[model samples]
Target: MLVDGHHLLYRAHFGFPRRVTGSSGEDLTGLFGFVALLRKAHREHCPGQEVFVVFDAEDGAADRAENVPGYKAGRAGADHSPVVHLPAVKQALDAAGVRWLEQPGCEGDDVLATLAKLAVVTGREVLVFSGDRDLYGLLDGQRVRALNTQLPAGRQLVTAADVADRFGVHPVQWPDFRALTGDASDGIPGVAGVGPVTARQLLAGGRRLEDLPETASGRAGTGLARARAQWQEVLAWREALRLNAHVPVPDDLLTGRPTPGLVPAGQLLTEAGLW
Candidate 1:
């Protein structure tokens, strides 16, 4: 199983109901919530599964920003409360013997994609724990599934069939689907008039943006026709949205053994002398 380190941290910091503090009154909500969530997920869904946590590097968005210019611009000005707790979280993870990685200039999504692909090719099933829809592109039936704990219990494990059933497009076309509809989270402004229904219609029949008909009539077709003026930009957005599954990761990272269950958050912090 692969965990999105920063994503989980942010989720824990902001979405966790109550504030948590250390003995010195320092905020430890992010650390506590992250460990608690990971522990619960591991105990319930993937006990004895090998877990690898991947964090986005400081410049992880640089490559995508150069391509799209506006990719994730909003995040720059957003609250960074979760970030201040990252060091403590890392310390706790180390104390608990949970192996985590952060590759320079690579996003956690891409690293997880690379790891998931490597695992699948090696005849191992993979589970990616992240709420980021961009990783949905990595879904390939039972071989690779995403664990979005933000979703309700039974629906957390998202499969390619689930993507196809919910979005009317295959998992492979997720980037294309998001490119047309625009991702507010990533700050990509899609075609002015195109929306989800139109986007879905354009990508119907498992077609990519490049595979769309050049000329057509009707609402969605006409929207596509109007969107042709910015077709190259949309293609670029799709390219930016696609996960790089070929990232260079160390071969020795995995030990090929099941990971032991994670200890509770408070216990880990105490053992690490972080509190």
Candidate 2:
């Protein structure tokens, strides 16, 4: 199983109240929630399967920001007090024998994607845990599944068929859809006036943003014109937002095993002062 560490922790930090703290008098909402989520995920999927937690290294943010000046700019200067105990979280995971991967110039999503792709090639069942909808594009045969945390039920299991049913387009067309309908969260400025409906229609017609009819009639026509005009910018942003799985994974990083042991939840809570 591959876990999007940053994505899940970020959500946990904001989803709960600010009162959650650790033994060091530091805020532990994110840490506590993350541990719980990890335990739950371990129980629910691949009980004895090996797990990899991927974290975003600091270097990648600069590249993403450089690619699009406004990419994730909204939270650039935000305070991270709520997640101050993240180091403890890492230590906890380490104690629990969970292997983690963090590579310079690569985000957690990239690591997750790379690991998932590798698992597919090895014919292993891979489950990705993340809240980012963009990862939906990675869903495929029984070999891979995406567990999105933003769904109404707390998680949405995504497969190839689920992708087609939910978005009316195949997983491969997800980037195209995002390119036409901007994602405000990611600061992707998609074609103006083109929302999901129009984007879906254009994608369904088998036309990329660059190939849409410029002066045609109806919503599709207007959407095509907008897409054409903003094609370059949108494409650039898409490239920026897309996770690269070609990142070299060091054999040591992938094969490292944690010291075997179970981290008692009570001990973790007490040491962290959550008790």
Specify the highest-TM-score model's number: 1
Task: List model 1 lDDT by residue over 104-156, tens digit each.
Answer: 99988999998888888889998899999989999998999999988987899
lDDT of 2 by residue, 225-269 (tens): 777776678788778767777779975554523233334555666
Q: What local lDDT score does residue 132 receive in model 1, on the 0 to 100 scale?
A: 90
lDDT: worst 10-residue window of model 1: 213-222
Best by lDDT: 1
Please give the lDDT score at residue 213 for candidate 1.
Answer: 75
Per-candidate local distance difference test = 0.88, 0.73
Report the Cα lDDT for residue 17, model 2. Answer: 43
Residue 125 miss distance in model 1 (angstroms): 1.0
